[model samples]
Target: MSAEAVSALGLLGRVELPGVAGSICTARRYVRGVLRRSGQRDTYDAELLVSELVSNAVRHSESGRAGGLVTVAVANCGESVQIAVTDSGSATCAPRIPPGQDEGAEGGRGLWLVRELSLSWGWHEGAAGRIVWFRLARR
Candidate 1:
């Protein structure tokens, strides 16, 4: 969904996490806790995608800098669940997948993995910042 179109329908929960390595763990835990409360058993892909997205926000967006934060919104999308990560805008960068994968590189597989694991995913820059989102079909 577009950054401005972040849906509130069936919203399960949301959390604003500090842009730090530690926040990745927090994001995962938050997702797990929320999903568990909703009785979602297959959380593997959701957890992994959330980690990847949150990590990218921390590394590439302005979120990683001091005082910066990432906002993660989780919601139910009928047959699937939606997860969106929003970070402070970065003038030099926006979300994208490399034309080719460099398996030998130390990083850069985040969005590609998101594409593979989620049912639908896209990103957009908004008035406030950037929002990257994905939906995993519920099992």
Candidate 2:
């Protein structure tokens, strides 16, 4: 399915996870199960993309506040699936590919993998939080 179709379907489920690393795998599994039940063959790829987005939110956003929330939303339109992760952070840093020498580093490759795997991905600031989202074709 095409991404444009998925966006038109709107969000299927929206979940909030605490700012903890363990929550990331749980969120990925939840998204995978949803896509799988929907007969999406690209469930694994969608899980991967969601993992990147959720991990970034958990790692970068400030936690412990009453309003701190990491939100995950999934949607499908028969042709494609879209996943978005939002956090209550105003930080302006954007994901980027590191230089050649940094390529061999131990970390900082999540967004790069998302770019390589997803049909399309981007980020924007919403009224309540910042959202990073990715879309995949449904096969």
The residue-level lDDT of candidate 1 at 60 comes to 91
Best by TM-score: 1
The list of candidate 1 runs beyond 4 A from truth reads 1-8
lDDT of 1 by residue, 56-77 (tens): 9999989999998998888887
TM-score of each: 0.92, 0.82
Model 1 steric clash total: 0
Among all windows of 10 consecutive residues in model 1, the one with the lowest summed lDDT is 1-10
- At residue 67, give the lDDT of candidate 1: 90
In angstroms, give how far residue 88 of model 1 lies from its true place: 0.3
Candidate 2 error regions (>4 Å): 1-7, 63-67, 99-101
lDDT value, residue 8 of candidate 2: 73
Each candidate's lDDT (Cα)?
Answer: 0.87, 0.74
lDDT of 2 by residue, 1-139 (tens): 1234335776677678887787789888889877777777667788877887777777776532444668787887457777878787645565565555376678788888888888888877666577778878987
How good is model 2 by TM-score? 0.82
